[model samples]
Target chain A: MTRHMSESDSDRSPDAAGRSWHDMGGLPAGGINPAEHDFALWEKRVDALQVLCATKGLYTVDGLRRALEEMGPQAFESMTYYERWISAVTKNLLETGVFTTEELNARMEAVAARGATYGDASIEGASPEGET
Target chain B: MTSLPHVDPPAFPPPYPSAAPRFAPGDAVRVATGHAPGHIRTPWYLRGRVGRVERICGDFANPEELAFHRSGLPPRALYRVRFTMKEIWGERAERGEDTLDAEIFEHWLEAAEG
Candidate 1:
């Protein structure tokens, strides 16, 4: 492999001089446990939204990545993976005028008034006759 | 991912006619070492490093432009760049002989003498 692709004057600037937080390739990190956990219902919804939006051309994956990357390293440390993704997706949607911030705020308020837990807050959580 | 809304992935954009491919197979090229601070696909480690053009990976819309809601039309030619671990990692390489390849756009590359 080396023979086919010869090396040049590898003025290879070492990593971390001006690199961004998201570009973590070739960097030292912790060992991977290769664990697989079941995705939460909200995480599944976020994933589904990501796929649907991207497929529907509502926003490109690059747009979502830009949102994710621009959110800075602090957000990465604070938020879960899916949480950050949904945040990015929502940002992209809002930036594109898919819906107004006021609309989102109102909808959020409505959702919160339903219940505390995720399953309980969902519409299906309510009985057919509106019983909890 | 696309700039236009409601269009499916299959309808994003076809490979633009390159007319003539710039870097052919086995050509030594270097990834441009520029950081514009926007959505970039080129990894930082590979920037400014020399590599061989393994194969032309066809042309597609530039992600950097598409991310900003711009029509990345007149798609750029994409190539599969190959680099040795030694070339990228220097003395810190686990296996100097091992090579890794990445699909990079033409605008991110320039011709180099091997």
Candidate 2:
């Protein structure tokens, strides 16, 4: 936007320019129509996880932002906001040595075996262990 | 006693003595064109843009370092810099008079010159 900008920034289309993927402040995009939304139970859980993790000194909020940025632009375009957040939070927890990869994968498998839908799986202790 | 379980060792950031403010309110400054990759609080659009220091937002832990689990020691001064829409969008600005404010850490700023 100024003379100080590099030729790469001025020469190419904003998308192709050597620009940080997340830096789209002045780029042409869709109209903004602000709207209120009711939080889903899962989304609230994600939020709570972030807050709890921060309070526990496991990671800073900035650490969570780093994880989100690391997910890349494809994930940004595809994943819902809270979905990205949960993914990021999970990653930071893993990085901090809170749990091992094998532990996480095994837990994920156990959870997946619980039921076909998230709602069915969420019912505490409802899983018929090793049904799969 | 046997080692306890279920308690996670806290990863708290080490306390850092704060740095003094370099620029004062109403001083002119420019945002640094920092391209380092990591979790950055400064937005890309504001890079190389010149603005006026609207106010001092006090010192805070450096988020860039904090993001990597490092102690953000020697806290930096935070400032609310004000930029005109025209400066950011050129002639495409809907109104040149409109302004945007960003909270920037001291390290991202430099003395502005004509």
Candidate 3:
């Protein structure tokens, strides 16, 4: 597997002094590059899969793979049970001086509430299926 | 020396001995036993890792038995295992915070050092 540089490494480039920016493909230096960010995203999704598998009693390998595939990376990051992964990802962002924990938590809470509303609506819509 | 009355060898104990003491929440364990072929719940990546027990999930009824296959075996117990992020991902994990959890079968557990 090809190893990518960490966020810190991306910020500083040995090739350029004073220039401060280096481009390897489309990704730039300074903030979390797309590749590193993507890895973090994938890791968070996997962590969420682990949490879901554990909580739902879906421990089997096949169950985990299916859950991961279904949850997708974005959905996994937003899941309430996988909040720890969200916190960790947010903490990483915070250490980079990107966002405060309180702010991130608030944003997550809002997103979760919206998701719950949507889920409830979907359940209500499906209620008529078996009602004879 | 003449042998006394010949006695049959003590019947070999059951091939897969029942899990010693069902796993419970808060137990520290490592995966130590299993031998089923094909896809399994416990991946090889997590085989020897140690983690804290988060919950004692109930017995696991074999999925195969429900689909018209043989049906004499009892369900296996399940446990939720929590591992530190560092243990699973090493330096890849962020510093300070450390933990992740996975559901595992009781057969996967062995005593882990504190």
Candidate 4:
């Protein structure tokens, strides 16, 4: 197979001088991985939320793409595809004042705490008894 | 009870006869270069590179404006630009037959000066 794209010998770190995250043009990507797989649970959730936002006319496809493009290069490089999607969606929501940062953080903390106590009945859906 | 909202993509502006197509197929053109603020659809690698117009792909709503949720007016012409791998990657390409074709908007291209 022919290899046309190759990165320089300099640091391969993202957001390096002279290259933005979106400018992956000729940069070496090791090699294209042809493997494909079904979306994970979280990935599906991200996609559903994005579709919901679009359906509600809360944001356009271009708007979401632009938001993804503007992400910090390091964060963009480190995040998985769906992770980036959720990040962009959350950023848009915050910018539009759909919810405050404090509220988001507190909700995340609550979910984390609930997850720690797997069988805690006080949290709905945490135990079979709670389900009833 | 609620129904799904009907949303349509941005509409294309009616064509103006006064604005004729600029570049033609086989015409040498250079992709525009320089810093631009806000969202842009043009790829960074193609910027400032010279290529040939493969064909006119027709005018469409400008994605740059659409990024901000505005109706892209005065639709921009879209063209398929063909570039050799060497032209884009310099001496980095392993094979000479490699090439890339991208659909670029008219605003991002200029007539290549001989």
RMSD for each model, in Å, please? 8.6, 12.4, 19.9, 11.0
User: What lDDT score is found at residue B66 in candidate 1?
Assistant: 87
**First chain TM-score, candidate 3:** 0.25
Compared with the true structure, what per-residue lDDT tens digits does model 4 show for residues A8-28? Answer: 223223454544567676566
* lDDT by residue for model 2 (A1-132), tens: 344244424632476444667766667788876998977767877898889989999999889888887888899679999989989888998989999999999998998887767643343545678456
The segments of candidate 4 whose C-alpha lies over 4 angstroms from its true place after superposition are: A1-19, A32-37, A96-132, B1-20
| TM-score against native, each model | 0.81, 0.79, 0.36, 0.67
Highest-TM-score candidate: 1
Model 1 segments beyond 4 Å from truth?
Answer: A1-17, A120-132, B1-19
1 or 2, which is superior by TM-score? 1
The best-first sequence of candidates by TM-score reads: 1, 2, 4, 3
Query: Which has the higher lDDT value, candidate number 2 or candidate number 4?
Result: 2
Per-prediction count of colliding residue pairs?
0, 0, 5, 0
Q: What does candidate 3's lDDT look like per residue over A1-98, in tens digits?
A: 01122432332234423221111222343575455322334355557655664455323333333333334446544664445443433433454445
**Candidate 4 local lDDT, B1-114, one digit each (tens):** 101112222244323322556877667788886456678777777776777777677777788887776778888888777777666655654764466788898999999853
* TM-score of candidate 4 relative to the true fold: 0.67
Off by over 4 Å in 3: A1-132, B1-21, B33-36, B63-68
- The weakest ten consecutive residues by lDDT in model 2 chain A span A4-13
Question: Could you tell me the lDDT of residue A2 within candidate 3?
Answer: 14
What ranking of all candidate models by DockQ puts the best one first? 1, 2, 4, 3
lDDT, candidate 1, B1-114, per-residue tens: 001111112322334445456987778888898877888899887887788877776778889988987878878899878887776766667887788888899999999877
